[model samples]
Target: MRKYLILGILLLGSMFSYANVSIRSMETELVAVGISHESIKEAENILNIALKKHRIMLIELEQKELEVNKLLIEDPEKNWFQINRLLDEIGQINANIKKNQLKAQIDVRKFISKDDFLKAIELHQMNLGVIK
Candidate 1:
């Protein structure tokens, strides 16, 4: 369990590092593809706000997950109820993160053109090597 938690933390750390790069790459690609300055700025503002909120939620989620792991390691039998409660909180945070991401995407789509938005997505995937 400890090993799993350490691995999860490492994976999440790497993902967060990649997320920062990905956001900047997307912004640069949007400009390179001739997306309007106004649209880019608007989309960037929306995304930044969402990203800020997401970072908070992710930190909370990570802390709660760590707490649960601690409880489990210390005394799974004695801390059963607390462990379950923390697990529930983690689930709720995960759900909220998903909802927040969807809302941000919808908000961004309103400010950016469909074609431009798709182009940015394609460029992002290409950067990740997800597309040939």
Candidate 2:
């Protein structure tokens, strides 16, 4: 049936769009944390591993979001049901993103102290400014 085929195509497209948006949002948040380059790389590596493990969960959330969108579009009367489902999926994704962000923050903090340690040594060697 051509109608069924068209529906399936739309569904898949929506799912992919949702997933890509989520991924981009997560990456943007990570970039905003202001970590050093070395620390950023390390955080990225850890995130990559965690994302691989949770790939399926992410995909499922995207699919749910897509379904909610479809439902909302089909009939204005079903807006509340679709909205509630979308909110739940958004919450789950937010939780996952927050968890990963905290992990990355911890990793970045570890490097910050080390960087400060090296800077102190450099300052001492140069006899620059007043040593505390």
| lDDT for predicted candidate 1 compared with the true structure | 0.74
Model 1, C-alpha of 86: deviation from truth (Å) = 0.6
Model 1 over residues 34-89: C-alpha lDDT tens digits?
77768777776777777778778879988998898799899999999999899899
**How high is the lDDT of residue 6 in model 2?**
41
CA deviation > 4 Å runs, candidate 2: 1-45, 53-58, 107-132
Model 2 agreement with the true structure over 1-32: per-residue lDDT tens digits: 43563465456445444433433344433334
C-alpha displacement of 41 in model 2, angstroms? 11
Q: Score residue 35 of candidate 2 by CA lDDT.
A: 37
TM-score of each: 0.67, 0.41
